[model samples]
Structures are given as structure tokens and as C-alpha cells.
Target chain A: MPTYLTQHQNRFLEELLDWLRIPSVSADPKFHGDVLRAADFIKDRLLEAGATLVELCPTAGNPIVYGEYMAGPDRPTVLVYGHYDVQPADPYELWTSPPFEPVIKNEKIYARGACDDKGQVYMHVKALEMMLRDGGLGAPCNIKFMFEGEEEIGSDNLGIFVKANKEKLQADVILISDTGILANDVPSIEVGLRGLSYHEVEVTGPNRDLHSGLYGGAVMNPINALCDMISSLHDENRHITIPGFYDNVADLGPAERAELAQAPFSAEAFTQSIGLPAAVGEAGYTTPERTSIRPTLDVNGIWGGYTGEGAKTVIASKAYAKISMR
Target chain B: MPTYLTQHQNRFLEELLDWLRIPSVSADPKFHGDVLRAADFIKDRLLEAGATLVELCPTAGNPIVYGEYMAGPDRPTVLVYGHYDVQPADPYELWTSPPFEPVIKNEKIYARGACDDKGQVYMHVKALEMMLRDGGLGAPCNIKFMFEGEEEIGSDNLGIFVKANKEKLQADVILISDTGILANDVPSIEVGLRGLSYHEVEVTGPNRDLHSGLYGGAVMNPINALCDMISSLHDENRHITIPGFYDNVADLGPAERAELAQAPFSAEAFTQSIGLPAAVGEAGYTTPERTSIRPTLDVNGIWGGYTGEGAKTVIASKAYAKISMR
Candidate 1:
């Protein structure tokens, strides 16, 4: 496109890889120093990009790298938000290559936070540098960068920081590059994302565990009771049976539904990819609509009584399940 | 009621308590010597009772203490059966006194296996002693005693022993003293006992666990599917839904049902005993009927996914339940 970007493409990637090697995993306390160092990496890059004000704002958890460049008083402000931290690379053996060691293969970067937010955040930093240093058309509007180090962990401190620095973050528009495109060719933009609510449910049958042979028919089994309760949450048609569960859920019109259905999808391929026999959901929705438009209640975990080795005939006193709605 | 029994009652109790202190737990291999010692106790007591033939019948597991007294050929031969081995005493802190150290409290002996079989088998030994040593009425018929040492376990060796010693175990009639009387005042006999069939059921959804946000409603969750399948096993009336489940179940007549209803029972007491809101079972059946006559299907245990301390939003690859029908 431009001579500056074409000449510095390899340098931009090398810089991104250097930042990725920091292993800023906020979930683990062992990466505390690395998380702070990653924040510093963002601070230096922002300063090098000719930002006038760059500060590593300290929060209860991790630091938030805030940087700003004012093109003019009349120009509209654009706030670019992203994160520097990545989720914990657990079950480490599952990866083909080391997670923190970023490597490129087949024109794709393989790393834990390569495409999540670190790579996207680096793109904005490099774009600002290209426009400022290329001796060409510079930034047309005021630019603000707010990169936090706790997005992978729940962003608990980010909420407090945003509230405390509301004036500093004021902008005409906000652009978050945290999500993904539908496909390379499609270049889709997600209009909305679902919110999450998690709950832990428990069922109590008897005060104490009892021998199944002595008390099977006479007393209630907690596991059975829990299963019954979970089953009743969904009706025969797979629609949730909770009263008023769908009362506030908005229904998409025919045109909107038809437009969503046009997104690239293959039912057979989807099922084959996940190693499932078929895709199943609510009665009246397509696969795409079921995942995007409709709310779903699912049991994330369930347990009671003897689940170890060999058989043990017991009617457990209590049963529990972790439920989540999206 | 006899003079001999009245005079030797205290001694008989003391002898039984001594045998109970052996801690013959067959389920645990750590008690191997104790189990063998308990078998020797039965053998010595049988010999002291003036048995004409006594032998320790060795099997793959613990030995069987066999003893016999031939009163007369014309008289009917009777074989008495019992066991010396007891179930493991675990969570031992729950016991009022040490399980191995027998104690007499409030006129009742407290010890593992004090009443299970060792107590009852000792009664037969003392009865034979009374009839032969007291010189009153003497032996009315030829008697044989078969006391085993692996009843607490699966009795795997007992099966092989019985098959090999068919001629030695032959008798006109057999009296097993292993069961219990309903109540001290209202003594009752059990004509039949229910059989058990156990099954472990599993439901597989995808090949691997999935993220709830990425694939919530689009794919079937194994835990939800398992819950649905388990819930469907019982209908609204609490009757089993398996085909031909009750095809051969014999229905008792009104007279038999009325006779069974005459047993002393209190619904409030039964519910209070187990700390349940109420006794629940198949409709149209009494509490006793549900426990005794009517067959039942119950989930002994159920488990899947993260059953740990906190919440994990996972659609597990597999869900499992241990089900049993009686």
C-alpha cells in the first residue's frame, strides 16, 4: 500500500513477537512481573509512536497503559481499547508449539495471544507510527489508547479505573478490536455479543447418605432429583420451560433472520468438526440463529454421591450443578 | 426360657462379645489374620459343644467352620448356616465405642458384627451345648453347622466351596440365622427378598469439552442429555418407563395387601427419621409397599465435568450415572 508499511512489515511483526514473549498472564500470580513488563512495552511503543502523553495508570489489579495524541482542538476524538494480557496457557501439552513463543507458519502466527488483543493492539500502534513517521498524511483526528492488562482475568479493576478516569476517556467514538470477522472474504462485523450469567444450583434429598438397598424405594435420591429438575428446564420441543425466560428476549424480523442465515455455515462440517452426530437446539431456530439470537441454559457441571472406581450403592444426601445462561 | 439358658445367659453374652472383638473384616485384606482368628473361634466353640465331626473347610478365601452332631439316623437332619466375617468399620469416629472393643451399654452389646452372624451362630452353639451337656431331652435330631468367614465381601469363595462340598452340606432342611426379626415384641418373618440389577449409563455429546459461549445452544450438552434421559426413565406417576419392566411383576391380591398394611408404621416418624419433607415413591402404594413389594429404579450416583470448588462453564464430552433397579 504505502512505502513505509511495505518497508517496515517485517519490523512490525518482530516487534509484535517481542511483546508476545513477555507472557503477561494475569490469571496466574507468578506472571506478576511479566504482566507489568508487558504494560511497559505498550508504554514505550506509544511514546515511540509520537504520543504526547503516555502513562501507566496503576489499578487494584494490573496497570492500564493510557496514551493520547491531540491532532487539533476541533478534531473528533477516537478511543482505541484493547488488552495486553492473555489467558493462562493451561493443559500446556496440547499445544503443537510453545504458547508464549510466537511462531509464524503458513502466513499465520501461532501463539496464545497472537490474534486475541495483543496482535490487534500492536496493529493500531504500528498504524499510528506509520502515519506519523512516513512524512505523509498524519492522523486526521485526536487519538486515545487505553490498554489494560486484566481483560483475560474479569477486568475487575478496569471497571474502577474507567469510572475514576471518565473525563480522560471521553471520546466521540470507541473502537474495540477484541472480536473476530466471520470469514476473510465475508469481512463481517458483529453488531452485538451475548452477556453471561452463571449460577450454582443444589438439591437436597436426605440429611445423610443412605444405603441404596435399604432406602432406595422409600427415600428420594438427590442425583435423581437434580436430574429431574434439570430435565424440566427444557421442554420436549427443546424450548426452555422457565416461566418468562423468553418474555424480554427480542425476536428478529423475517428480513433480519434471513440476513443472518446468509452467513457462511455448513451443518455437516460443523458437526464433523466437533465430532457430534448432529447439531440440536430450540425447535424453531437455525444453527446460526440458535447460537446468536436465542438465549440458552446449559448445565456446565453436575455431581453427587459415588463417582470414583467400582460400584457403590448409595443414595447421596445432596447433588449440585453449575448452570450458565447466554 | 429353659433352666440351662436362664443360668448361662450372662456367660453366653460374654462369649459372643469375645468373638465380636476379633474384628474379622473380610472386605479389607489388612484384617486377614483377624478374620482367620474369628473362624478359629467358631471352630473351637463348635468342638466344645460336643460335635462328633468338626473340620475347617478351607477355600480360596477364608475358611468355613463346619461342625456336626449325629443324634440319630431316624431323626431328620438339620443344617444351620451363619457367617463370622463382618463389614469394614470405617468413619470409625461415628461409633459410640471402638468397633473392635465390645461394650455392654444399656443392656445391649455394641460392637461390629455383634448381632450380624457371630451372635446368632453362637446361640446355636450354646443351644447344642445346653441340650447335650445338661442331660435334658438331649439332641432331638442330627445337626450340622456351616459358619463362613467371607460374608461381608462378595462371598466369591463361598460359591466354589458350596459347589465342591455338596455332599458334606447335604441335609433334610436348612435354617439360616443371618436375617433379623422385625421387632423384639412384634417378631416377623420375611418370606421373600428382592433381587438387584445395577447399570452404569453414559451419554456422549462431542469428542471434547466445549466452551459454553462458543457453542452453547448450537450443540447438545452431555450433562443435559444425560439428565433428560434419566428423567425420562420415570413417568409422572413414578412408574418405570422401561419396556416390559413390570411384565412379570406379580400383583398381590387385596387380602395380601391388607395383611401387609397391618404392620406398625407411622408416615410422620418415617419422614422424620431420615429428615425428609415427606416420603415419596410410586403413587397408589403405601410406604411399606414401595420399600418392599414394589420394584424401584434409582440413580445411585451421577457425575460429569468440573465438580470442584467453583464454577467452570464447560459442556463436558461425557456424562455418567450409576442406576440400580430392585
Candidate 2:
């Protein structure tokens, strides 16, 4: 296993870099061809890994890559879920290097999908390859790989596919490698996952963007009204002010809370890492609890009136914001 | 009054166009010089409008323009609050004409800040001029104009200025023309204002972005996790799920709600106005109630992973979102 791991590390990195170069964002329709090309790339890689019955399953949005490797009926069956699609890389100027030009810097592969599910999903493929080379193809697990191309957009069709192909995707436990460690140095398992609600709010004031000087005193500035509305969501204590929001919140006991707090956390270190003044969250909870156990609300993106290069004194006719909760 | 209104209508419109041409966005630091230039423009305009004691008050972020006209000691005082700042105009391609070049089509001025506080606020300035020219300035009120240049950036310094100059800014009723009319033809006044809370959230999974293929099953995609988290904010009924969020929401009586619903509204008309599939909001309330009386949560903006011109199949290490509440 060690020999195989060492022998293929460089080649695996090179192949992954090539894969990263293809723009396969499924969220956007303009990348339809790129997504198809990515599907082909994954199909080829699965075949190279000694997999049989590899095919691209067509869906409403993007294609799903499926393959099977059955050792015997007695073996434990494992189903792997992944996506070849990625999120759109925007604010492109923020990138230190071209996002697609995967680079190896400071022992880390720098690319858009380097450390995300791509790197982790590839690890399992490599593990399967290692088993094949070492004459362990008849290992304990009968592995099945199911890679989709639209998880980034919201696996709109995945649930339907799973329901329809229950027998094909049957497994003891669905093993997914799309999460992260608790920290860079500490390896931890994510036992619980939070749910989400995404929404866009449009606050329309006037019929169109108006001049602030002419309408400042008579009309509502949606941006100002938006800011005022947002400011009132939390009180001085940092608690969300929506009515009945906490009715179903399951509280954590002191013991569990204490154990979670024992995880090594340094405020100074965390602040330095993020380049922030200080960490902020719900007042009564620790940072870990605020992020992991307790639910949180945040503004993901906001724009209404004017968010441009210079300034226009016109009041925006409408202000918009995107919010998320967990 | 009609004569004065008619005489200055075209001139007022032209002058405002010139003012809108100056980009005075205060949120961005690069607009520092432009902001100063805008302040000078306001000062010259105020002088022309017969304002005495007009000066620009400097703050940490943007400058504030203050002016006063003391008609008499016994008259009622009206303090006007406004902002000369505008939002950043981005996605510039979306504009039909240059955001700075104010265009009047179908009797409506189109520009970035045309209908926002700039246009709204300018009406008061024009009204003040009309009052002074028609010898109506000494009619019944002592008007004080307080225009700040940082309203677009959260009014960070204006709050401090307001707190510091409480005595100087005293008035019986603070008349701000920053809101808009309920309908295009019917003039409406905003009697109540909504409060707000805005926040940005960052979710980190791995130390860096990962490839979905290798890491899909083993690790968490911040983008996916963020989506999941966001999806949980509202329930199947679209009500927010945050605990204790609605503790302070003041519910209006049925009569008040009914009266508000009487405002001219049509589902089809509203839908056609914004070019949306349909008008959507909290299930139980009318559109007017949802926008005005009821507190709401929305995702103002959202971004995570790669959102660029091309696709990059990366699970982002971090995902960000902005949320607004009322």
C-alpha cells in the first residue's frame, strides 16, 4: 500500500491538475460543453482504475458518472457520492494564480477544487486502485462510484435518481468525502450536519432609482431602510430577533458542551488566521458551538441601490440581499 | 406656488442631472476625492439656494454637509436628514445608459441614484429654493438641512454626528425625504420605518478549497454546507427557523392589516413590474403586509467557491453570504 501510494502521488497530482483545468461549473448554463468534457474525463479515469460498467447517466441538468466493481456477494457494499461540477469562481482578480492552472505551493495543491471534494474523492479512487494493484481487488468492500455533475447547483435531480435506482445504489453506509476537518492540524469526524434555508429579499421603494437630493426626505431609501431593518434583527446581546425562531432549537447539555469546548481553540490564533479584529457570534455560546451545534444567520451577499466603481447619488429603486441559515 | 413649481421644473431637473453625474459613492475608499468634490458641489448649490452657515463637517469615513435658515425664533423647526452618498454601481452592463448620464425616458429620470435619496432629497432643496424665492421661507418653519455623504456605507459616522450634535440637530419633527411613494401616480407617505440587522458569515471546511472527486465523501463542502445551512433558515412554510428570533415582533391588529391591504395592489401587476415568475413571500400575508409590516429575512448576496467566467470544479474552502432582516 505504501509503495503504491508513493509511486502514484506525483502522477495523481498531475492528473488531478489536468482535471482542474477544465471549467466544469454546473451552476451556469454556459459551461454545458465543459461539463460534458468533464464527464468524459471522469469516465476515462474510472476505466483506468480497472472499473467495469462505467457510464454517464443523463439527467435534467448535468450527467452522472456511475461505475461498479463487485468482488462477490459476501463483500460489504460501499457507495461513493461525489460531483465533478464546481462552483463558479468569481471576483477572479482575488486569485493569486489562475484558478484553473493548478499549482503546487507550500506542499499544497492550489486550484479551485484542489482540497474540496475533488481531492478527497480522488483519494478513494486511488485507494481502490491500490487495492487492484496489490491483488486485493477481492477486498472486503464491493465499491460503487456515483459521481454527479450538479451538486454545486443543488442536487436537483439526485434525490430522484437515488429513489429510482435504489437497488443499484444499495449500500451499508453512504460514505461521502465532501466535508472538512475541524482544523488544519486536527482531524475530526463531522457526525452531525446542519440544514439550510436560502432566500432573496427584494425591497422596492420608488418605481426606479431616484436622486437622493430630491427624494431624501420624502421617500424611503431602500438601502437605508434595508440597513435599518437588518440592524434590528439582533439586539445588543447578539441574539436573533425573529419571533419564535428558537422554538425547536435542541439545547446541548453542559457535559456535551464542555467536551466540545475542550477542542483546542485559541481566539488570538483564530483571529490572526482570519485577519479580523476579534471573533463574534451568539453571546452565550462558544465559537465552536456557534458554528457547529447552534444555528446561525448571516448575510451572504447584499446589493440594492448602487455598488459600483464610483458613486451615483441616486437612491436605488430596489435593494437586494441574500441570506442563509443553518 | 404653482407658478414657482412650473418655472423651476425643467431647470431643477437639469441641475439634478448634473449633480447625479458626479460619482460620490462613499462606501469605497477610492471615491474619497470624488466625495470631497461632491461636497463642494452641494455647498455651491446650498449657497445658491440662499442657505446661510453652510459648511462641510468631516468625519472618519465621509463628510457631512450642514446648513441652516433661521426664518424666525417662534416658528416650528424642521430638520432634514439626507445623504449625498450613493451605492457602488456594479454589473454596469445591466444599465441601459451610462449610470452617470441621467436619462429621462417617459418622464422618468433613469440613473443610479435617480429615485433614491438623491432625487428625493433634491426635491426638498428645490422646495426650499421655491420657498425662499416666493418669500415662503419665512412662512412657518425654521428648516435645517443635514446631509451626510456616508449613508450608503451604513451611516457609520452620521450616527456619531447625530449623537454629538443632538442640540444643533433639534427639531419638532425630523422630515427626511429618503423614502418613496407607494404608487407611481398616488403620493403616499411612510409613517413607520423598519429596523434591520446585516451580517456576513464565513464557513470554512478544509484549510483550503478541495477537489470534489477526492474529497466529496470524506469532507464537507462549505458551499454545500452553507446551502444546507441556508436552506434550514426557513421551513416548508417559508417561516424563519431561528430560535427566539420573533420574540419582539409587534403584530398589527386585523383592522390595521386590512387597511394596509387596501392599498392599490395586484398580483399580476406586481409580477409584471419586476419580470418575475410570480410574487412570493410569507404564505399568510398580502404583498404589502409582507413588505411593510411583517419582518422578513432575505439573502442579499451570496458567493462561494468559484463563480467566474468559466467553470472550476472546486468545493470552496469558504463560502460567504450577506443577510438583511426587518
Top model number, DockQ = 1
What TM-score should be assigned to candidate 1? 0.73
Across A97-155, the per-residue lDDT of candidate 1 in tens digits comes to 99999889999999978987899999998888877885747999999999999776567
Angstrom error of the Cα, residue B202, model 2: value is 1.2
lDDT of every predicted structure (CA atoms): 0.84, 0.69
Name the weakest run of 10 consecutive residues (lDDT summed) in model 1 chain A: A305-314
- The digit string of per-residue lDDT tens for model 2 on B17-112 reads 988888886757787788788777777777777776788888877778998877888988899888787777664766789888889899888886
For model 1 chain B, give the 10-residue run with minimal summed lDDT.
B305-314
TM-score of each: 0.73, 0.56
Q: Write the per-residue lDDT of candidate 1 for residues B1-326, one digit (tens) a residue.
A: 98978888888877888899998887677888999999998899989888989999899889999999998889899999899998666546556789989988888888888777788898899989998876557899999999998765556788798889899888998888766444466666666656667778899889877767668999999999999999999998888899999988889999999998998777787788789889888999988888788989888778887665444567888889988788
TM-score of chain B of 2: 0.92
Task: Return model 1's CA RMSD, one decimal.
Answer: 6.6
